[model samples]
Target: MDMVNPIVLFVCFIVLSGPVLIVAGIIDMSKGSGTRGGILTVLGASTMGLVYWAYSAISHMNFSKGRVLRLKGRARVARRALGDGWADDATPDIEGLTPWQRTVLGEAWLYSAGMEHASVPAFAKLSLKLSAMGAPSELLEACHLAALDEVRHARRCFALARAYSGLPWSAGMIPELSQDRPQRPSPAEGDDWSRLVRGSLLDGCLGEGLAASVAAEVSRRASDPVIRETLAVIAEDEGRHAELAWDVIAFALERGGGTAKQALRQALDALETQRSPSLPSIPGVDEAFLARNGVLPQAELGRLMEECIQRTRARASSS
Candidate 1:
């Protein structure tokens, strides 16, 4: 799941351009070269069709901007949390891989890094909002730790991206954000309770739960030992992150009661609409190749996603 890099999109569009051929074919026909013109016209129409397909696929295969970011009106990756103690010394084994494989893997990790980078602030804000609601110190502490873990996750993915692509990409910067707002985080208030519940249910529990499941599958499928090991570590961390989300929901339900339950139900109902559409067919990223490189191919990813969503709903209902 790579971010649709605008630069790549532009390059692809140019390479797939059919207008020039079409226009030339029209000119050739006006000059009495009907045979050549007919051939060119047919080729041009076919090329145009291919171009349309490519554009559709690329647009549909957009980035997985995590749900937490979406809840806060920060759906786009902010590219903050600059380079520091983010990467590890572990080397990703990229030997014997085709150039396209390397690229597919690199972009996958790069997109993941962006999502993880966004989570740092997401957790920080969660902590602040919880604190405003007079949440327990343990919950606050977990939020802080989760933010740190996201920093580590982003670093690992960034390191892997650089390793696979030989590109010098870093999480852009760390912005200064003040968590001290004048607003009271009172759980007694209806609006506060609803916001807290919605955030915990949609962003935390559902989002992180799905993330953990997907990472586990990716880890299981990877043939590259180093990549497998890296994802294993990440998958384990994501499981804990999902637990923390549930913990938040648990606390919210305890204090907010029926109001919280209603919010949870509303959030659960919204899941179907929010579920990502099936990924489009990507170039050089077929089912077999992606599975071996720690990436779920489109079909596998779709199935896993449905499973995760169903599991999340069951868990949320019981909780």
Candidate 2:
């Protein structure tokens, strides 16, 4: 069966349901009844429904007959680092995959999952920091929401890893909630506001913007429907995250005065010399397979990295 784009479906669901919920909530509130709460509850339920719907739609979109959902629970596996420095816990059961392919897929997805998981803590910290800095409510909300989005992205990537390997995987030991906070540079090292702006420039503007571009390009080139679908969703979310980063930077510059701008410029200059490392080619694995599975070739990756740098530079210069 042909599958509609999960993003398109999600947008449609949001557009169709958002107004209905708002109208119903307004009507119910007008009657002085508790129906407003009910409407909000329904809206929440509908959003969850949409998430599941999109998941199912993507799962069924691909022609692969392999089982896609054999694992149990919320799919929130803990991330673990192996002795080889790889963040992997389980071996996949995918048949016909070369050892190189397995290694590539496992390592790639594990890194992706790690980043997603890490983003949860990153955003949470950002939200707290922004709040303490007296940022506007909208920015605070965006930071919190971005954290939630990262959680979803982690699960989604983990699911993709499982699908590729056809094995139930684990990330090893789960840590306490308090231990999950991201390790951020302390204000003792430098000015707090400067650190914040620099972090935003390096992580949000440069890192996420580059990731969005790569994800979008990979989505276009991916032959596997499921991989394409997953990358598409990631690309959209990452683009938004980048925008949020830029927005926060703008806000900081507006309020932070010369110190913030100087810090941002310095960070950009420091990052300018950093370049993406090229992926090593495996002897037997075809580039086609790698690309199909969401890995861009060296040439394409280099181009994307250049584009990201240029875009970030442009934004910084214009600011």
Candidate 3:
């Protein structure tokens, strides 16, 4: 409401309506009923009209006479979360990721990295959208950063999956990252431990365990020296990642309130039900890699998962 230049307000209207139109068009395409498509088209057009009307009404209001008070709140929130002021170039270069790790990590990471990469601007674009809807700037900035991290993690995991599958990494059908869409207003539930575990435990701990298992098995099975060496290196990293997850969970539990404790318990329960993403059907992947690496037994993978679970459980019990 900073009496945003009229042009900025107009552009915002377009940006907000674009997605609604895209979805309506998709629904129209899916319908074989000619009448259904017409109905959807009408609905979409009506939505666009409503949005334009609202924008026009707000734009004409005198925001200078304390009518713009909401804008001040949003700016304050942004300052709190983004710190000092927004930076034009806040993107950080991720340098330590090995090329192979970057490639294969994407496949495994797609499951949860939307949440993980919540820090990225791409993911946070929605939060920026909400800021326009009267959300504080700090909250929007927090959302933005969270989306950013999730997207980057997705990129890393996809890179790893590509190497494993021998297919070039692409976003393809990956779901767009989400933040604050569920509309929980309670602070404690929003901050709960179970959500923490769901967000962190699988990837941080069990996921790493699977990686290590695959690596160890690959070392035993692979005849090709390159394959063996690659698995060995990747496995080492997975092991470290799993350990890091455990440490983080522990720290979160110790420092966190009621939500963290409950969430940890639930996360431990989920570990029992966890399964790895099905290995892609690459040429010779079954015989050349999985069988040789002892992953064919499948039970071995279960055992590795169990080991990770036990470690997590023990940490929780101690806490």
Candidate 4:
């Protein structure tokens, strides 16, 4: 009994189940029994089945995608660690360690920041994928610009983190981030409004809001002038990003009519429901930093949601 074989079998089972349930749903919907009770039963069962199938399918796909990314990321890390020629271009040099070991520690923090900031570029790529769903070319360009800004911010932060720690830092210290795998859109893909709304919620509302919160905290906590200034600049850029996201969402919603409004409301409600009571834990990131600086409470997860809602509502009122 190969352990890996069972995992592969389980994946196959999920793939089969997803299509089967979807087909069954269509059959149930097509049945014209001309009876209310039968219709209701079919409707209820099929709806439940579809929902379950959809959730499982998405979870499985997301997991598989994440695994592939991790594998590729590990390869990159290994190559860098092995003193590969390509690594030098991105890696930074560490100077003499401060007596306090702050240089090494700061490097770690900045490493995490770089990875997180990599999401900005990741999202820009996402915008390219989203282009099929009526996303404007300008919006995609903005995503690319935002990604560049994030990369700049990450580089600056990493350098400062190294400098403050009194470590010798140089270029090529960090490696490129792994890319998220390609995802195929479903049959319901043509629903442009839903796509825009959801993307806005995730990218603008959640991502930007969380960034702003983190930046504000970074600005508040650092005792060093350079670190403080670096954080301040990042925070200012993030603020603009968040505002730009809101503007994009509002502009789209205004032209989309009642159906779009309903979709927006539904998305917002869904976001509210999905809001967590605890903050997301990222590797090497300390909750204490956030807590100490008047940003988000370590255990709280709704900072982005709260901020998003506030921003969205304000936009609505003014419009």
Candidate 5:
């Protein structure tokens, strides 16, 4: 059986429960409950309904309705006998792409694939750190799954690159996973918690949050069917990844006290200072063509970046 759409389920919950809550709140007030309690209940119900409506409208505007694309095949990372680190070696045969299109697609896919590979080590580090801190099993499991997701992302991106370029693409040497990895001091016996908090804030919350926002914007504007579908899938996964980051942060804060909170605030401020106005534009790339192919134009990218920064700052301040 096909799964129910989460968006539909959430909307139904809001619509059905909202009125019931409001009416019950009103009746409670009439039956002599305290004014403040009743007012809070009614206000909460109204807020939920309004928020759901607004979110639904915005999502509709940004995401086009289409049948879900089923992804097939598998891509795996293979170690080069003469080189260090793992790379995806699978190359599928594809036809009909022009040289220019091939170049654009190849570069784009390679960039994304490389980032996905990089994420593997990053997530692995996070999982180990969380494990050291005795984090709950669920969070640990999510971190492990996230690493696996990055593997899948790298494979899919490599496949796309190969298809477009009509040549094999390999994930080049990644230093992080190399056998000659740089030696670093272990996390101080008691400092693991602090390190975890900082890493989650910088990598998970800020980095993944920005990634998800950009991916969603690109998917929304993409004209190519393959590009749109692939990016949509990536955006959905990135959104969940970002949420997991925040969840980890919350978990840390619950036990981390004021020190953790202060560290997170400092991290946010530092990230804001390091922010760029937009994603860098590829030289010699046609803006119109990039837009058509799911690449965001510099102007739109800048606008979206600004919006994401503002939202992030707002959340930080409120927290």
Candidate 6:
């Protein structure tokens, strides 16, 4: 939060990435994207071996997993984005790139598009959760803005995917995201405070903290100027999102007393899961090419994830 405390805001951003990838894979399978689906399924499951060693009550509103609709052939819809500011519709130059190269980048961006698109609804749901709890206007407003940021993010990623893949596709519908959404905490539910605490800790702090770090790192290393800038923007916004989670967790702890504190303490055990990278290597992808295009290898990203966890531990100890 604004001040240092026993609980730190720095948590694993990619801590839940394994599960997300697995969920994405399942969705991919449903969409008949066997190549990505199979890969995501296997890697996601294995990554969970590193994760899911603990951290029960992982679903604070089921974490809002989103689905991407893979449309049939060249039918693209017109996109009305949040606004035309910065890289709203920017695409990387593919002047010297091969078709296969484009396909690889496209696939990577497509997956990223799904993740970003899902976040749009996730933030909207978070705002609902805050409103039911009667949170501050600032928090509520931030959620709305974050949702807009995600919308822009999804748009750009989809555009990049379209450019690289040479496909006329955009984001698909996500009815289930709203349908199975977590309801606001009714008075009868009673444990709303705990839910808020854990949700912010795991999802907001850890998740976005790791996200900000990874995006920044990827942006820094990426050879493509447009990709670098796009990630830089995402990195900055995700950093703010991480801070919002910190503020939310801090506020909950202050108000919810032992229940909230206890929730936070329990989620802290997630730090112990910090060990080696769990994901297997991609079979046909060239590591250097992917890196140049802004896609870091799974193992390297894992290392960055572990580093974030370690940094959190150090900061917690010093604080």
Candidate 3 lDDT score at position 65: 10
Model 5 global lDDT (CA atoms, 0 to 1) = 0.61
Give per-residue CA lDDT, model 5, range 171-262, as digits (tens): 66543244433245354312545655666665666667767777788877777767777777777777778778888888888878887787
Better of 2 and 5 by TM-score: 2
lDDT of 4 at 44: 57
Name the lDDT value of residue 65 in candidate 4.
Answer: 8
Better-scoring candidate (TM-score), 1 or 4: 1
Better of 1 and 2 by TM-score: 1
Among these predicted structures, which one has the highest TM-score?
Answer: 1
lDDT of 2 at 302: 77
Name the candidate that leads on lDDT: 1
For candidate 5, which ten residues in a row score worst on lDDT?
A: 64-73
| Candidate 3 structure quality by residue, lDDT tens digits, 1-319 | 4454333344345446655664766677686655666666667777566544533432221111100001211211111121211222212222344332322222232222222222233323434444444544554554444444344443443333333323343433223222224445365334534444444576555655555665676556755454455456546655654554565566556656677778777677767777533322322123333344223334455565566667766765676
Write down the lDDT that model 6 would get.
0.64
Candidate 6: tens digits of C-alpha lDDT, residues 187-285: 533487876765676667766777788788778778989989888888888888878887777677777888877666666776776443444434335
TM-score of each: 0.74, 0.66, 0.42, 0.51, 0.65, 0.68
lDDT of 4 by residue, 65-107 (tens): 0001122223122111211121112222334433223322443
For candidate 2, the per-residue lDDT at 306 reads 87
Candidate 1, residue 306: Cα displacement in angstroms equals 2.1
lDDT of each: 0.70, 0.65, 0.44, 0.48, 0.61, 0.64
Q: Write the per-residue lDDT of candidate 2 for residues 121-203, one digit (tens) a residue.
A: 66876788898899999998888887777767766666666545333443454454444434564654347678778778777
How do the residues 1-319 of candidate 1 rate in per-residue lDDT, one tens digit apiece? 9786543454345445577777888999999999898888888887776655544553333223233554323464655343555566656887787655565566677777778887888887788889988899999998888888888787787888767755656777434333223456455334767877777766777677667777787788888888787777777777788888889889989998898888888888877865656655766557676677766666666776688788888988897
Candidate 3 similarity to native, TM-score:
0.42
By TM-score, the candidates rank as 1, 6, 2, 5, 4, 3
Alpha-carbon runs more than 4 Å astray in model 1: 1-67, 80-86, 173-190
